[model samples]
Target: MRKTALFAALSVTGALLSGCGTAERLSRIGRAPDMAPIADPTRDPNYRPVSMPMPAPQDARNLSANSLWRPGSRTFLRDQRASAVGDIITILVSIRDQAELQNTSERSRENSESMGIPRILGLDSSYARFFPQGFDPSRMIEANSNNGSQGTGRIRRNEAVTMRVAGTVTQVLPNGNLVVTGRQQVRVNHEMRDMQLTGIIRPQDIASDNTVQHDRLAEARISYGGRGTVSDVQQPRYGQQILDAILPF
Candidate 1:
């Protein structure tokens, strides 16, 4: 019995040692993997991060229209007189006859009456002094002289009266001389003349919406030429009579 008990104890100890050796070998294998060096993320030149660009603010200097109208520049008025004359002629020639004039005159009178003003008020003609066309108020920068790169300049609107006389033509003579003598009631039309506003924009204040205002003029005129004869003497008087009949002022 003592021998059998001693043999069982030895057998149990050998089994435990064998199990421990297997477990240690597995642990050694796992530890071997940990001994390798970790990879450096920065060392990879090809692993570039995706990048995005930021949005830029709108630049006014890039607008071509805004750059044309510089403030306080008189270059815009170079041909203004000729333009105004052309516009007046166009309006006059378009009248066609006394019938159209009567219609236009009646309309003007009605408009004036509706506004609660005198019916026979003088029809005054004037030009835009410094009309700002396509002018964006938000883009208007105050004038500055110090900054060369800054768009700091003055912009002006200008207007003038080409002609201002009371009356309408009773007849456009066959010889191209208008007869103004008749006192018969007549009419006139208010029309828009083609006028251009020219200017420039400074470099810094370029984002302005610079545009011209159209059809702002309310009055126009007609001209006639005559040699030193009875026609010349009677021409102005006839014109005055026609104006009185139509305008009644």
Candidate 2:
């Protein structure tokens, strides 16, 4: 009874806390979702610097005497690829995945045991006359057992997504890799879509037009989601989510 009362109290407290958002939504019943303000990504409280193992720095490239062409330069003019912090680069995102798996397992066991005293210190001969009719000491005890079990499991999944977004070079690692971060938001009638991407890419991977493919980015983190009338209706209530998380069954 005490446990049940405590759980009920917690549920009520959670519902009350979640009601604050509900009240805000109610005030904007007929209005479209507000768009987020434009701000510097580096100023965000969640922003953090990226660090990794780097090899020792190498000496600068030596230039030839009176040569206009520089060694290791992709073009005679200044290279246009994004190599420094605060530069913009376009990212082309494309993903497609499909998987299927099935598993089965089976187990079985059987055992039998028996024990008897056919001739123990002549006692069986002495008690033979007094034993019950059709009784046999050779089969005094016996046991038999059998066990079996079987299980099967299966999984299937498919997903596909394609989009493009411009990202800013947030940092330049000691090894010449560039860290990039980008966010895109679109608001439609009573709905909003949000997308975010962050990763590191090598300078050589950038094309002449300043575009890089998603596959070239390492340690990538991508998110695509939204929140609005349709999204709210599709999600479970706060109380239901709390119960789903805490309930044993």
Candidate 3:
């Protein structure tokens, strides 16, 4: 009976060892029932780089349209509405009176004469000549008379001319000409000036402020404004002649 019991114990121990070896082999082969699959992150097409785009900065002062024109504003002429080119505008400047002119003339004459310049006391006056686009003196003389005569030239009113004031009228000459007593002179030309007119469209003037939002996610609670300008240059009928008078002879 003792020999039979020993053989039976050995058989039971062998069976237990065999069962543990089978479990080890199954784990090595990845055939174990509870084994998890390996994760491959690179296999995902949705994977992206670590870097991302940041949100843009907000400008607080830029909120209002008038803010653009305020001193120290970020938006300059280039950014303003009136900043655009091709804008046309006009401006007018009136001449001052005779007493004021006399005072100015006296000061200038004193200054020039004191500086070792010639002191001439008289108004400078001259008749300005006006002709068509193409003027021929020979043709003009021939038109006056068949025989060339000094005082027989025909002056046509087709050319428009205007009297320009020059220097200070020191004295009235016997003939109605002004004795201009200075070096300065007046010029005749197309009067042109640039003027800027800015137009602003406030948020309230447009649709409701609530309709527009700051950020895509947030509601717009701030007021907004837009601005623009109109510009033009205006000239008189005889602008070209005016330019010529202003130029130094």
All candidates: TM-score? 0.14, 0.87, 0.12
Candidate that scores best on TM-score: 2
lDDT string, candidate 2, 1-249, tens digits: 999999999878986879898888888898888887887888999999999899999987788898888765677867777888899999998988889999999999999999987888878866657875756778889999999999999999999878899999999999899999999888988899999999999998999889999999999999999989999899998878878998999
lDDT score, candidate 1? 0.30
Candidate models: Cα lDDT each: 0.30, 0.89, 0.28
* Model 3, CA-based lDDT: 0.28
The residue-level lDDT of candidate 3 at 164 comes to 22
Clash pairs for candidate 2:
none
Give the runs in model 2 whose Cα sits over 4 Å from its true position.
1-12, 126-134
Q: How would the candidate models be sorted by lDDT, starting from the highest?
A: 2, 1, 3
Candidate 2: worst-modelled 10 consecutive residues by lDDT: 126-135
Candidate 1: regions farther than 4 A off? 1-92, 100-217, 230-249
For residues 1-249, write the lDDT of model 1, one tens digit per residue: 999999998667556645674454456442321222333322345433222233454544443565665543345633221121111111112222322111111111111111222222342111123433433333334442322232334444443323222222222323222222111111122211222111111122211222111122122223333222232344454335546767945
Error of 3 at 8 (Å): 1.0
Worst 10 residues of 1 by lDDT: 81-90
Model 2 RMSD, rounded to 1 decimal: 3.0
